[model samples]
Target: MAAAIMNLVRVSDPDTIVLGGGVAGSANFVERIRSYLNPKTMRFVSSARS
Candidate 1:
Protein backbone atom coordinates (compact mmCIF):
# COMPACT_ATOMS: atom_id res chain seq x y z
CA MET A 1 0.00 0.00 0.00
CA ALA A 2 2.81 2.37 0.84
CA ALA A 3 4.60 1.52 -2.37
CA ALA A 4 1.45 2.18 -4.35
CA ILE A 5 0.94 5.50 -2.63
CA MET A 6 4.54 6.45 -3.35
CA ASN A 7 4.04 5.53 -6.98
CA LEU A 8 1.00 7.77 -7.17
CA VAL A 9 2.95 10.54 -5.52
CA ARG A 10 5.72 10.17 -8.05
CA VAL A 11 3.23 10.39 -10.89
CA SER A 12 0.87 13.04 -9.61
CA ASP A 13 3.22 15.13 -7.44
CA PRO A 14 0.34 16.26 -5.29
CA ASP A 15 0.74 18.82 -2.55
CA THR A 16 -1.60 16.92 -0.26
CA ILE A 17 -2.90 13.43 0.14
CA VAL A 18 -6.13 12.66 1.92
CA LEU A 19 -6.71 9.15 3.17
CA GLY A 20 -10.09 7.67 4.03
CA GLY A 21 -11.97 4.40 4.43
CA GLY A 22 -11.48 1.53 6.90
CA VAL A 23 -7.71 1.13 6.75
CA ALA A 24 -7.12 4.83 7.04
CA GLY A 25 -8.96 4.80 10.35
CA SER A 26 -5.96 3.02 11.83
CA ALA A 27 -3.40 5.47 13.07
CA ASN A 28 -0.71 2.79 12.90
CA PHE A 29 -1.54 2.17 9.27
CA VAL A 30 -1.27 5.83 8.48
CA GLU A 31 2.00 6.07 10.34
CA ARG A 32 3.35 3.06 8.54
CA ILE A 33 2.61 4.65 5.20
CA ARG A 34 4.21 7.87 6.33
CA SER A 35 7.25 5.94 7.49
CA TYR A 36 7.73 4.37 4.11
CA LEU A 37 7.68 7.69 2.34
CA ASN A 38 11.05 9.22 1.53
CA PRO A 39 11.59 12.59 3.14
CA LYS A 40 13.33 13.89 0.04
CA THR A 41 10.45 12.88 -2.21
CA MET A 42 7.88 14.25 0.17
CA ARG A 43 9.60 17.56 0.81
CA PHE A 44 6.70 19.53 -0.67
CA VAL A 45 3.88 17.09 0.01
CA SER A 46 1.57 17.60 2.94
CA SER A 47 0.90 15.00 5.55
CA ALA A 48 -1.53 12.26 4.68
CA ARG A 49 -3.18 12.80 8.01
CA SER A 50 -3.55 16.54 7.61
Candidate 2:
Protein backbone atom coordinates (compact mmCIF):
# COMPACT_ATOMS: atom_id res chain seq x y z
CA MET A 1 0.00 0.00 0.00
CA ALA A 2 1.22 3.40 -1.02
CA ALA A 3 4.23 1.66 -2.44
CA ALA A 4 4.91 -0.02 0.84
CA ILE A 5 4.84 3.27 2.66
CA MET A 6 7.24 4.75 0.22
CA ASN A 7 9.58 1.87 0.72
CA LEU A 8 9.61 2.49 4.40
CA VAL A 9 10.22 6.10 3.77
CA ARG A 10 13.26 5.35 1.71
CA VAL A 11 14.75 3.03 4.24
CA SER A 12 13.73 4.53 7.54
CA ASP A 13 14.41 8.16 7.25
CA PRO A 14 11.54 8.63 9.61
CA ASP A 15 10.52 11.62 11.59
CA THR A 16 7.13 10.29 12.51
CA ILE A 17 5.02 7.54 10.93
CA VAL A 18 2.94 5.54 13.35
CA LEU A 19 0.38 3.25 11.82
CA GLY A 20 -1.46 0.47 13.62
CA GLY A 21 -3.34 -2.68 12.67
CA GLY A 22 -6.51 -3.42 10.71
CA VAL A 23 -5.44 -1.61 7.59
CA ALA A 24 -4.40 1.31 9.65
CA GLY A 25 -7.89 1.75 11.01
CA SER A 26 -9.57 2.17 7.64
CA ALA A 27 -11.28 5.54 7.01
CA ASN A 28 -9.15 7.67 4.75
CA PHE A 29 -6.15 5.53 5.62
CA VAL A 30 -3.99 8.32 6.81
CA GLU A 31 -5.09 10.63 4.12
CA ARG A 32 -4.37 7.97 1.57
CA ILE A 33 -0.83 7.73 2.73
CA ARG A 34 -0.55 11.46 2.78
CA SER A 35 -1.70 11.71 -0.75
CA TYR A 36 0.76 9.08 -1.89
CA LEU A 37 3.76 10.84 -0.47
CA ASN A 38 6.79 12.17 -2.40
CA PRO A 39 6.27 15.84 -2.12
CA LYS A 40 9.99 15.82 -2.01
CA THR A 41 9.50 12.99 0.41
CA MET A 42 7.23 15.20 2.45
CA ARG A 43 9.82 17.75 3.41
CA PHE A 44 11.44 16.30 6.53
CA VAL A 45 8.39 14.23 7.30
CA SER A 46 5.98 15.33 9.95
CA SER A 47 3.52 13.12 11.74
CA ALA A 48 1.31 10.41 10.28
CA ARG A 49 -1.18 8.59 12.40
CA SER A 50 -3.58 5.68 12.48
Candidate 3:
Protein backbone atom coordinates (compact mmCIF):
# COMPACT_ATOMS: atom_id res chain seq x y z
CA MET A 1 0.00 0.00 0.00
CA ALA A 2 2.84 2.34 0.78
CA ALA A 3 4.56 1.37 -2.41
CA ALA A 4 1.43 2.04 -4.40
CA ILE A 5 0.93 5.44 -2.82
CA MET A 6 4.58 6.20 -3.37
CA ASN A 7 4.27 5.39 -7.01
CA LEU A 8 1.29 7.69 -7.38
CA VAL A 9 2.92 10.54 -5.50
CA ARG A 10 6.14 10.17 -7.43
CA VAL A 11 4.33 10.10 -10.72
CA SER A 12 1.83 12.85 -10.03
CA ASP A 13 3.67 14.99 -7.47
CA PRO A 14 0.67 16.49 -5.79
CA ASP A 15 0.79 18.87 -2.86
CA THR A 16 -1.82 16.95 -0.91
CA ILE A 17 -3.87 13.76 -1.04
CA VAL A 18 -7.53 13.89 -0.29
CA LEU A 19 -9.10 10.62 0.77
CA GLY A 20 -12.86 10.48 0.67
CA GLY A 21 -15.66 8.13 1.70
CA GLY A 22 -15.06 5.31 4.18
CA VAL A 23 -11.31 5.57 3.76
CA ALA A 24 -11.42 8.90 5.59
CA GLY A 25 -12.78 7.42 8.83
CA SER A 26 -9.53 5.99 10.15
CA ALA A 27 -7.25 8.58 11.68
CA ASN A 28 -4.71 6.01 12.88
CA PHE A 29 -4.71 4.48 9.44
CA VAL A 30 -3.88 7.87 7.97
CA GLU A 31 -1.12 8.37 10.47
CA ARG A 32 0.26 4.95 9.63
CA ILE A 33 0.24 6.00 6.01
CA ARG A 34 2.05 9.25 6.78
CA SER A 35 4.61 7.33 8.80
CA TYR A 36 5.27 5.02 5.89
CA LEU A 37 5.49 7.94 3.53
CA ASN A 38 7.40 10.90 5.06
CA PRO A 39 10.77 9.50 6.14
CA LYS A 40 10.83 6.44 3.94
CA THR A 41 10.07 8.40 0.81
CA MET A 42 12.95 10.88 0.96
CA ARG A 43 10.93 13.28 3.10
CA PHE A 44 8.80 14.33 0.15
CA VAL A 45 5.55 12.43 0.49
CA SER A 46 3.02 14.73 2.09
CA SER A 47 0.32 13.49 4.46
CA ALA A 48 -3.13 12.63 3.18
CA ARG A 49 -6.28 14.62 3.90
CA SER A 50 -9.85 13.52 4.59
Candidate 4:
Protein backbone atom coordinates (compact mmCIF):
# COMPACT_ATOMS: atom_id res chain seq x y z
CA MET A 1 0.00 0.00 0.00
CA ALA A 2 2.78 2.41 0.93
CA ALA A 3 4.75 1.48 -2.16
CA ALA A 4 1.70 2.09 -4.36
CA ILE A 5 1.22 5.53 -2.82
CA MET A 6 4.87 6.42 -3.41
CA ASN A 7 4.46 5.35 -7.03
CA LEU A 8 1.42 7.54 -7.40
CA VAL A 9 3.27 10.53 -5.99
CA ARG A 10 6.22 9.99 -8.26
CA VAL A 11 4.02 9.69 -11.33
CA SER A 12 1.43 12.36 -10.56
CA ASP A 13 3.63 15.00 -8.99
CA PRO A 14 0.65 16.61 -7.34
CA ASP A 15 1.01 19.84 -5.42
CA THR A 16 -0.63 18.20 -2.47
CA ILE A 17 -1.57 14.61 -1.72
CA VAL A 18 -4.28 13.94 0.84
CA LEU A 19 -4.46 10.42 2.13
CA GLY A 20 -8.19 10.21 2.89
CA GLY A 21 -8.67 6.51 3.54
CA GLY A 22 -8.61 4.53 6.81
CA VAL A 23 -4.89 4.82 7.46
CA ALA A 24 -4.85 8.47 6.44
CA GLY A 25 -5.82 9.70 9.88
CA SER A 26 -3.25 7.73 11.82
CA ALA A 27 -0.49 9.71 13.55
CA ASN A 28 2.10 7.04 12.82
CA PHE A 29 1.15 7.00 9.12
CA VAL A 30 1.18 10.77 8.99
CA GLU A 31 4.60 10.85 10.61
CA ARG A 32 5.85 8.22 8.20
CA ILE A 33 4.81 10.36 5.26
CA ARG A 34 6.34 13.47 6.82
CA SER A 35 9.57 11.65 7.37
CA TYR A 36 9.57 10.03 3.93
CA LEU A 37 8.37 12.85 1.68
CA ASN A 38 10.17 15.97 0.63
CA PRO A 39 9.03 18.96 2.72
CA LYS A 40 8.75 21.07 -0.42
CA THR A 41 6.28 18.64 -2.03
CA MET A 42 4.25 16.90 0.65
CA ARG A 43 1.85 18.45 3.18
CA PHE A 44 -0.23 16.38 5.60
CA VAL A 45 -3.53 17.35 7.16
CA SER A 46 -3.58 17.18 10.93
CA SER A 47 -5.46 14.13 12.17
CA ALA A 48 -6.18 15.90 15.49
CA ARG A 49 -8.53 18.33 13.73
CA SER A 50 -9.85 15.98 11.07
Candidate 5:
Protein backbone atom coordinates (compact mmCIF):
# COMPACT_ATOMS: atom_id res chain seq x y z
CA MET A 1 0.00 0.00 0.00
CA ALA A 2 2.81 2.34 0.95
CA ALA A 3 4.66 1.44 -2.18
CA ALA A 4 1.59 2.12 -4.23
CA ILE A 5 1.11 5.52 -2.62
CA MET A 6 4.78 6.26 -3.15
CA ASN A 7 4.41 5.37 -6.79
CA LEU A 8 1.55 7.78 -7.07
CA VAL A 9 3.61 10.43 -5.35
CA ARG A 10 6.48 9.90 -7.76
CA VAL A 11 4.29 9.95 -10.81
CA SER A 12 2.17 12.84 -9.72
CA ASP A 13 4.82 14.87 -7.87
CA PRO A 14 2.35 16.77 -5.84
CA ASP A 15 3.14 19.39 -3.21
CA THR A 16 1.59 17.24 -0.51
CA ILE A 17 -0.11 13.92 -0.16
CA VAL A 18 -3.28 14.29 1.77
CA LEU A 19 -4.29 11.08 3.46
CA GLY A 20 -7.98 10.92 4.11
CA GLY A 21 -10.21 8.12 5.43
CA GLY A 22 -10.18 6.40 8.83
CA VAL A 23 -7.24 4.13 8.11
CA ALA A 24 -4.98 7.03 7.15
CA GLY A 25 -6.05 8.84 10.30
CA SER A 26 -4.55 6.14 12.51
CA ALA A 27 -1.19 7.00 14.11
CA ASN A 28 0.28 3.54 13.69
CA PHE A 29 -0.89 3.23 10.12
CA VAL A 30 0.55 6.62 9.26
CA GLU A 31 3.82 5.65 10.87
CA ARG A 32 3.89 2.41 8.91
CA ILE A 33 3.31 4.29 5.68
CA ARG A 34 5.99 6.80 6.59
CA SER A 35 8.47 4.04 7.35
CA TYR A 36 8.55 2.78 3.80
CA LEU A 37 8.36 6.28 2.35
CA ASN A 38 10.84 8.17 4.47
CA PRO A 39 14.34 9.21 3.30
CA LYS A 40 13.56 8.10 -0.22
CA THR A 41 10.52 9.74 -1.70
CA MET A 42 9.14 12.35 0.67
CA ARG A 43 12.13 14.39 1.75
CA PHE A 44 10.23 16.85 3.88
CA VAL A 45 6.67 16.47 5.07
CA SER A 46 5.24 19.51 6.77
CA SER A 47 2.55 17.71 8.75
CA ALA A 48 -0.50 15.56 8.42
CA ARG A 49 -2.65 18.37 9.74
CA SER A 50 -3.43 21.75 8.29
Candidate 6:
Protein backbone atom coordinates (compact mmCIF):
# COMPACT_ATOMS: atom_id res chain seq x y z
CA MET A 1 0.00 0.00 0.00
CA ALA A 2 2.72 2.42 1.03
CA ALA A 3 4.79 1.49 -1.98
CA ALA A 4 1.92 2.21 -4.32
CA ILE A 5 1.28 5.59 -2.71
CA MET A 6 4.98 6.44 -2.85
CA ASN A 7 5.02 5.64 -6.51
CA LEU A 8 2.08 7.91 -7.09
CA VAL A 9 3.68 10.76 -5.16
CA ARG A 10 6.90 10.36 -7.07
CA VAL A 11 5.07 10.48 -10.34
CA SER A 12 2.66 13.28 -9.50
CA ASP A 13 4.58 15.52 -7.05
CA PRO A 14 1.45 16.83 -5.50
CA ASP A 15 1.46 19.68 -2.97
CA THR A 16 -1.01 18.21 -0.50
CA ILE A 17 -2.80 14.96 0.23
CA VAL A 18 -6.10 14.30 1.91
CA LEU A 19 -7.28 11.14 3.66
CA GLY A 20 -10.97 11.05 4.30
CA GLY A 21 -13.82 8.58 4.67
CA GLY A 22 -13.88 5.30 6.68
CA VAL A 23 -10.16 4.63 6.74
CA ALA A 24 -9.66 7.85 8.69
CA GLY A 25 -11.76 6.28 11.42
CA SER A 26 -8.84 4.14 12.49
CA ALA A 27 -6.85 5.62 15.40
CA ASN A 28 -3.38 5.36 13.93
CA PHE A 29 -4.10 5.07 10.26
CA VAL A 30 -3.17 8.67 9.45
CA GLU A 31 -0.06 8.64 11.58
CA ARG A 32 1.13 5.40 10.03
CA ILE A 33 0.50 6.96 6.65
CA ARG A 34 2.35 10.17 7.46
CA SER A 35 5.31 8.27 8.82
CA TYR A 36 5.62 6.60 5.46
CA LEU A 37 5.19 9.72 3.32
CA ASN A 38 7.19 12.38 5.15
CA PRO A 39 9.01 14.71 5.08
CA LYS A 40 7.91 14.86 1.47
CA THR A 41 4.50 16.48 1.69
CA MET A 42 1.72 17.71 3.97
CA ARG A 43 -1.66 16.13 4.73
CA PHE A 44 -4.97 17.79 5.50
CA VAL A 45 -7.62 15.84 7.39
CA SER A 46 -9.73 15.66 10.53
CA SER A 47 -8.71 13.44 13.41
CA ALA A 48 -10.75 10.90 15.28
CA ARG A 49 -11.48 12.74 18.53
CA SER A 50 -13.17 9.85 20.21
Q: Could you report the Cα RMSD, in angstroms, for every candidate shown?
A: 1.9, 9.2, 2.6, 5.1, 2.5, 5.6
Could you tell which candidate, 2 or 5, scores higher by lDDT? Answer: 5
Worst lDDT 10-window in candidate 3: 41-50
**Candidate 1 regions with alpha-carbon error over 4 angstroms:** 46-50
In the range 1-50, model 6's lDDT, one tens digit per residue, is 55666677678876655556898767688667656754534242232233
lDDT of 2 by residue, 1-50 (tens): 77787888789877766778987888787677778887785666665554
Minimum summed lDDT over a 10-residue window in model 5 is located at 41-50
Q: Model 1 over residues 1-50: C-alpha lDDT tens digits? A: 87787788889887767788998889898888889888887676654443
Candidate 2 lDDT: 0.73
Sort by lDDT, top down from the best: 1, 5, 2, 3, 4, 6
Candidate number of the best TM-score: 1
Candidate 1: clashing pairs of residues: none
Candidate 6 lDDT for residue 16: 54
Compose the digit string of candidate 5's lDDT tens values, residues 1-50. 78887788778877877888998879998888777876745665555542
TM-score of each: 0.70, 0.28, 0.60, 0.46, 0.69, 0.52
* TM-score computed on alpha carbons, candidate 1: 0.70
Q: How many clashes does the backbone of model 3 have? A: 0
Query: lDDT for each of the candidates?
Result: 0.77, 0.73, 0.68, 0.60, 0.74, 0.58
**Candidate 6 residue pairs in backbone clash:** none
The superposed Cα distance between candidate 4 and the true structure at residue 7, in angstroms, equals 0.7
